[model samples]
Target: MPTPLTPPSAPHWPAPVARTAVDATVALPGSKSMTNRALVLGALASAPVRVVRPLRSRDTDLMADALRALGTGVAEDGSDWLVTPGPLTGPARVDVGLAGTVMRFLPTVAALAAGEVAVDGDPRARERPMGPIITALRELGAEVDDGGRGALPFTVRGRGLVDGGPVTIDASGSSQLVSGLLLAAPRFAKGVEVRHEGPPVPSTPHLAMTVRMLREAGAGVETGENVWRVAPGPLLGGERIIEPDLSNAAQFLGAALVTGGRVTVPGWPDDTVQPGDALRGLLAAMGADVSLGPDGLTVRGSGTFPGVFQGLEADLHEVGELTPVLAALAALAATPSRLTGIAHLRGHETDRLAALVTEINALGGDVRELPDGLEIRPRPLHGGVFHTYDDHRMVMAAAVLGLAVPGVEVENPETVGKTLPDFTGLWTDLVRTA
Candidate 1:
């Protein structure tokens, strides 16, 4: 085998290995998806809305700043955000950063503003897919200037009212396309009817989340086969509470499964449309005992040393965000694993499928890249420098590997700030307490 990789070229973080089975109660930050959705709906609400326990991270901060740029007031009232609607005027610049939600969701909001709003982001943000949203916007009667490129670094000229009605597009690459339109539909002159006509929309649960949140905010939404209708109406935003980010919770729970330890994530919702909730079944199938109670959800190892659970045969299309952690677990499983239905991951913050394969194989693991997914043959993983590619999920996945493998360094460890600013510190505490 190739020699273990030395430290990376730049600042690297040493991932700590677990000395014992981790037994910690982790309280995660609020959901990024729900926080941004609340921000959008709160901005469009007829009255000031208070979002309780919202996540404060780079992605959510960007969303709040974008709304503030559009003449809304987003102030911190304790851990909540009190969003007061204002005249949607702009001549403002919206820094989308690397946030897919901000980049995809804000343009439609800006279309309802009076002046011009410039939307741009990190260099990688410009390369991400934005054509679907842009095309649908123009069809809905909005003036968007993109300098001939369908991607970001564009400007949306707002006439203060979108003439929304019917539009069709392929939303296979990302679910943000449909969610973005529905979010801005309430402010449109005629509401919106979106028809997704491509490969099954990846992350359908996220779509359901959007629909559920919309209806909860008093908007009329009708869902059909690959179709969604949002009626033009006033959004009644009062006080809304955000659930903990179950996606991020995957990292902590994965730790318990790997160490043959126990972990409880307090405040797990009894009912949620969050895609990460799929972990309950997925982890149980892999031999971890998962239970949901009044306090939250708990996962314990199957009395097997090192928690060598059965390999996974899962389709992670709707929960593609969990692939990195699952891929990491597959690398350490006792049997071979096959994960499918996540080809859409190529369009995420990075080409995740490609990145996972390259980094895992570099660490002395056997992982094959498929056209749509991965086939992992568990093997001994040696310590090495695992590159994160600035993707937050990639960073968390590497940390999971470090639990069993020694001396694994994660490049660009700070990248976890994208979604979970306190990820490293929280992870350290979990390992230390264990």
Candidate 2:
């Protein structure tokens, strides 16, 4: 039985005060979304897929469930997973929670089924983009309902003899559209070659994650990080462990920089491929005592930072996901700073650029919205009701800001459950005291 997930309304926050420096070691969770996508891809591969550290998050869990529905044998061995692929006998039913990954990826997962597979997700997930992939699937002869303007509540019929074709996907909304079709292509009678031409493809790193997982699964894929080609090939089971999330590391890094806290995030991959590493350079510019250790990095925030310039200027194409937190930091800075290369922020959990402009300005900040990012001048943020717009990142962006400013309250703070259900507890180790 699947329970419907209605994001509790936008949350409100409490006022925060400048806290004394705290030091702590945080055990960040594996990226649930990444792990699940990799798991599904691995199930369709040709090697003994061994996932190193997979996510137990809600979205990734949905991916696992979907895999089970397709008859893949997946089990956990200590901290790793051994996935054994089986032929998909679907026409199955899938329920994806508010996880956007499941909603997006399941359509392709549907393509691997023997008959029609009905995939449903949380209302929010349902509302997200599926049209591009749905349309692509139809173009590839997978018999799917377009849902009128690129909507969901559709079906994928994988009867037989369906061959991949040349199709242009409107990836302007999500790069997952491209990844889903790419991964599903190899299973088609013929392979799929994708052409991307919208919004320049957001979070290309995430797409890279998908491609890497596909490669590990014995998929013959060719793409220059964006455009992709997947051909029919042998897929088998293997073992794998996911890398620690670089996105979560950003907040801890910001915490260390904002409050001079000493935080250690172990379990980091040495050959990490996440694009969120732009934080290191950003923190250094903001005047933090930062260094990468053999295990992880250490950041010590000294208030005497942000020497001259009072701000920073950099195109964070690589670390676009961290824009919200970085925007918060810039607003809390001594002077104005501009962030660019984030036009795609508009399409995230919420219209991030608009949300940032509205919320920060509402709190008496002299912040302006950019086509790509935010231009924030030093402004005192007072305690006011800030909404999360049912997006986890917004909640965290506000929470991070709350730590730096007095009277910054975040309502409906529980939306972090998408990935971090225990954030409030996690931060209690260093927040709200002194």
Candidate 3:
């Protein structure tokens, strides 16, 4: 197994403070979600595929390496990735590296291999919920030996095929559970019919992304009220251009709202299944003038600090990934905000809800943790250390707060490399130009 990434000696990074309203155009990297999904589909394609402008972050890299270990050829062609599909063989070791996508999405792909595939990851990856997928994969005729742990550090004894048919799972914990099954279903002997039996699945947009991408690859897919079916067929290989990660754009756009500045992210898709696209509406609700045009998505803040924006009251069930930045903005709002319908965040990189509450309150903010979400009442926030808990989004939240609250030191800021490697650099540029 490969060694886990190590943090630098200096763990605390003092976040940049914005002295003026930030007015800049930030071009972000490709979507990590789309990039990883594309890698999976490309590897499963019948022909060579090219992925254009894919994110080169830790999470996406792990996906590429995992596919390579399964005998797929992933090569870099300039800024693009050329994926050559090969016979899916195993007896390989996969290190998931604390990436939720890797730990959840790759096992089904491994199941299509001919031999044993051992999967493990960072310590936290072992604590994540894997039971639902494990149970569902077994029901679909894959032998997964987790030593009864039902999590990571398991082995999938592949038989070169999976008899995928109807399998039910409680995907309430994560939408990835559903996406993982559907992505590899095209190769299953009987394809797959995934039916969710428990609570409403979080991050529904991500599921839409999976279905759309599958159809784009020429796979037959059908969706119903609470179920999805992918017919066994060939996934076509072709060029796919990934859009900018709008989720990563959250902090930059939130900078506009917090500092009463203007920020725009180019290459914003008019229509996207990425949950980050919801930021347009969410940021607008918080009093930012949002517009999408030839210049991409532009967010103009109404006013700077002391010029209060309205608090937000909404259910972020569909876009739970944007919770941290939105929560940070809520803490800086003029009124109280109630964000609900996101209990599933408890199983994310960390218990995001608890982390947000703890970190925000540590800076002397008033945040109440609810059963499913967070309630933020605007309070006078002071400078203090904001703990990231090794979650990338946590680093983003701290950056947003640092723009308004001085002396906000962030611990383990390097964790942002999970999705955006140049996060600190980009943030400093935006703030410096402010």
Candidate 4:
């Protein structure tokens, strides 16, 4: 009966509306997983590491605690963290908050420890998946016990993993699986050889970013298209400057594109591998002017807004998490949009496709649900009360619909705290500029 919320203060924008002429530039938050992964890498390496612009979020904080539990010298120096790698031993407890990354990644981080670590998190975190990590860890000689059948509140008894050479992980379900195991390989007894086979991998680019960052930290990693191999070695301490999240920028881009305005997001990584950058192309296809710059990226709106002139069959398997927002766009597009390759959305914080259809349809959009994705036809949505289905993306996506169309009230905006805690403030700032 408990549901996450946006907030009462944020305006309830209605559908079948449009953004008034507006223009503004905004800054983005740092990547939560990337910072935590970098910190973990720093802890597993033999040198001191610094993370520039690290995010102060629940997820990252949990990772820091987990890293510290592993005997890593973790200290904060302003926005930077000074981490010294040492021989890490597991602790009696590891709590990962509500982070999917921490739950998945810490299981492997525990494999490198020498004692029994009972890992758990908040109530919602208990509902998330942990099977892939448990299966992989067991195969690699880790004694892991889940809630009962490899679930949470489980214990991973580590005797220091022997190099489990050439492991194959079906990470298509969650790219975090790939990032989790790959980063933990260097600490394995025999190092790790990971072969990833799944439907089409979700968030391949973010997984690739994990691989790339590991190598930068001094781990030997070879990612030959599909397969990834990591050699056992310490990640050397170094400084990694994490850029503002491009993923978060995609939402604002949606905001500007929906409204008749130019929204510039500063400090985005131009050459970054984050797949959220794919939003640039997705929005452009719908008739938005998006540009990348040295300091950031900008989205100039199209008042005409051809509205997803491209065909509706979008392969969102790589960046499927964006389906909720994209679904809203599809609802307002010239033709129906069918998003495929994301059955995994059902397993997220909420059943996203269902949430998309239920909330959007309630708002008067012609949205329908499919087994794996959705088929949405262009329709004028009448803003009313939009339920966010306890999902942060759902809350924000409904908010996006508000920018162009007025009268849509997003229920429980606080759910945005899962990632962008600054949502209300950011919207206020943008509204002020407009």
Clashes of 1: 0
What lDDT is obtained when candidate 2 is compared to the true structure? Answer: 0.71
TM-score of 2: 0.88
Could you list the CA RMSD of all candidates, in the order they appear? Answer: 2.5, 3.9, 2.7, 3.2
| TM match of model 1 to true structure | 0.97
* TM-scores for all predictions: 0.97, 0.88, 0.97, 0.90
Off by over 4 Å in 3: 1-9, 304-307
How well is each residue in 1-434 modelled by candidate 2, as lDDT tens digits? 11213344544457354457657677787876568777767767655577777766666767888888877777877877777777777768788766667777777767767877777765556567777788788888778865575665666776744678687887867777887887767777778888987667776777888788777667788886447888887765655567777787777667766675566777666566577656678877887777777868676676432221236777876567788788877777666788888887665566778888888888888878777778888876776767666667777778777776667777677777777777777776656432
Q: For model 4, how many clashes?
A: 26
Residue 207 local lDDT, model 2: 80
For candidate 2, the clash count comes to: 34
Better of 1 and 4 by TM-score: 1
Better of 2 and 3 by lDDT: 3
Give the per-residue lDDT of model 1 (tens digit) for 9-43. 66888998998788899999999999999999999
User: Candidate 4 — which residues are off by over 4 angstroms?
Assistant: 1-19, 304-312
